[model samples]
Target: MNEQSISQNKIENWREDRLPNLSGKCFVITGGNSGIGFEAAQMLGRRGADLILACRSTQKAASARMMLEATSTGTINLVTLDLADRSSICRASDGVRAITQRIDGLINNAGIMQTPKCQTADGFELQFGTNHLGHFLWTSMLLDRVEAAGGRVVQVSSIAHRLGRIHFGDLMGEKKYSSTKAYAQSKLANLMFAFELDRRLAKAQSPAIAIACHPGYSNTNLQSSGPTGLLNMIYKPLNALIAQPSALGAVPTVLAAAGLEAQRGAYYGPTGFFDMRGPVSLSHIAPHALDLERSARLWAESEKLLGISFLSQD
Candidate 1:
């Protein structure tokens, strides 16, 4: 970086150089089978943190486990977590509760992007259900454990959230739906949830922290796995030129998960222009994500919908 850049951040544009000993730290990362999630799992594993990959496919989890186990300095385990289905989420939570006593970190990284309008098992919009609600529920279910361990929760959002507005009236997209709009809303929800969780943790005088991160533009299968269209065809060719590799994309995630000086309620992302790609630092949060009242409403609505009250003011 140049002199001006250093003056702006003053943190030496640092990345994950060395990590503290995490020999017994346990981190649960969703979507750890591939992409940035897998990269993060590798980073944490190498630091000797036992890993629980809450992924969808058992077959892919097996393959991912073998890959991690080869170079992993810690143990790796897997449990089925289909974020689109409520029953599946609860079952996965039961499995998670059975194994570890406390959780060092919970990375809510798994998500689905733009796709044709679809509903989850409970009739919620696919993007909202999988990206936001499911994670909201899963993280809440594990909050007590995380609190007991004095752990942190890392929420992975996206820059696309800048365009998002929560369509509270049509959350399920039953009235109308656009894939990109739905995705943007879900990502925005991720941010609101992260920040709101931080607020609650503070209110309760809890030791746990809630932080968020964005990977910038990365060439991950997040696009390939979605519906095919003109954008997909064009994006596939441009991905190599425009997007960073998943390894670099995962740096912000690792920093948020285990950074030494990471602050509570902070949102980290690439400091590059438009936040496409660069060194990880504090990224700009959108106006919608700043509305404390809206976040509280969203929290209340989420609790009502999911039928769970994770944080109750004492």
Candidate 2:
């Protein structure tokens, strides 16, 4: 079908439902203070899931916790996690390990958009570092615990990924940086990691599923963080007219996290126009995202750049 027709069908079919069995599950949602992440956390919490709100600011995390507690029937905890820093990721993971023996799910939801050109504490491009590498290390560090509990890992990607292309030589955007290109590249990395992880899990006979979802022009704080000036002006109105509400944007994530039929490496997103808005569905996967060679190379490069090994020492 043509792209226009495909998107219209998706918007028309959107729906939501409660998954009662999620009551005892444990979930960690990064960037849970606002936007799609916050809504996803709220929905899961309402269904009785114990949540860890991972954010860069403790103050925001605390506020989010209170909001969740006020609106949800389950438990919520705050944990400071700066995804731009590898050490911070380690510290947060250790903290989670100290308190809980099992982690049923992890939503790699924290990300930055078209911010000013910058580098992370780890020296990688800011968007790439926080959006992909940080989450990669966090997942690797928590893999054993997740495996023991037979958990799922959800990578919150974006439909913008369709326009992304990885520039291996300039991965850090050292030569030049366009905020939009960097943001898209980082998101594509996320998609690649999710798919590659699923393949690795299957090969190792691991029980965890690595799934991906996109929010499709959701009205979230992400749009507010655009590069400013003409770009912001352009995005603002476009988002206002076409973006879904944060609650509706959380559907694909909820489906990936708790849906009974969710599968490893499955991609989910809105069914509407160009996947920028609609009902949840099994979304199309980009061909480059499924390239095993690229995935493996990216995995190796990620480990090297982060100075962390994903495989267990044992």
Candidate 3:
């Protein structure tokens, strides 16, 4: 159907119950062992989608799998994926490739928030390396399979992206670094990658699409994962009052992944109170996030850092 000539037979409120029966669909979710990612996996699993949880710890993965097995109708599997390490991601991708020839969807839901200044295994800034570059390589390696299945890529960004600056001059944050600022840059990169990937996919006439979402003020261990500080202290009480539960927080992600209403390059998040907590809807895309030149540069830099190219022979 044309843009204006649309059918009313599409999903409006995307919730777990409304998810289409995904009987044979297979999805690989990063950080699926806990919080929003786990919730998203469970929701999709209930709808009959086979789940591959790519986690950093096999113990946690097994626990998540055991929990999901009880409630979901589909099979649950796990792969060790340490997004902070390039070799780990490659091994994880290889493991996933062995399991499924085609992937119905890929949820880049793993991330680290404001954390102490650190570098990944490859010496890149921890947040940017794990959140953006890791997913970039992981997705590119699996793009062919996703395209083969006409699947979608769901990238989970955050509201903090509004305050981000790429810091290209010191991308590693070695010259100067602030935890919050670095986190913002990583999230912003996530959105930029989502939009650029979709553009590239369309240009290449690929069937797969790249979509994005933010969980809003979900009270997950994401904050505690970094370092104990004021953010963590206030997070608990603030979350109790304003933050939605993890199940609710995962709605936007599930919408981006399984909802029929989602479109290529479309970003989704909560619709209420500064886009922090409420039902999922069309999210605001910052003007900077749409800068084509910056997007291209970021893509180029990512390839340079990762030593790989995607979607073209060159």
What digit string (tens of lDDT, one per residue) describes model 1 on residues 1-314?
11223244433344767567689989999999999999999988888889999999999999999999987898898999999999999999888889888888999999999988888999888999899999999998888889989999999999999999988898878888888899999999999999889889988999898989899999899988875687688788778788988988888888888878666787788888688898777887787787888888888888988888878542
**Which regions of candidate 3 are displaced past 4 Å?**
1-12, 312-314
Off by over 4 Å in 1: 1-12
**Candidate 3 clashes between residue pairs 3 or more apart in a chain or in different chains:** none
Model 2: lDDT of residue 122 = 75
Q: RMSD in angstroms, all models?
A: 3.3, 3.8, 2.6
Q: Which parts of model 2 have CA positions greater than 4 angstroms off? A: 1-14, 312-314
Model 3: per-residue Cα lDDT at residue 76:
85
> Of the pair 2 and 3, which is ahead by TM-score?
3
Locate the minimum summed-lDDT window of 10 residues in model 3: 1-10
* Backbone clashes in model 1, listed as residue pairs: none
If scored against the real structure, what TM-score would every candidate get? 0.95, 0.93, 0.95
**Candidate 1 weakest ten by summed lDDT:** 1-10
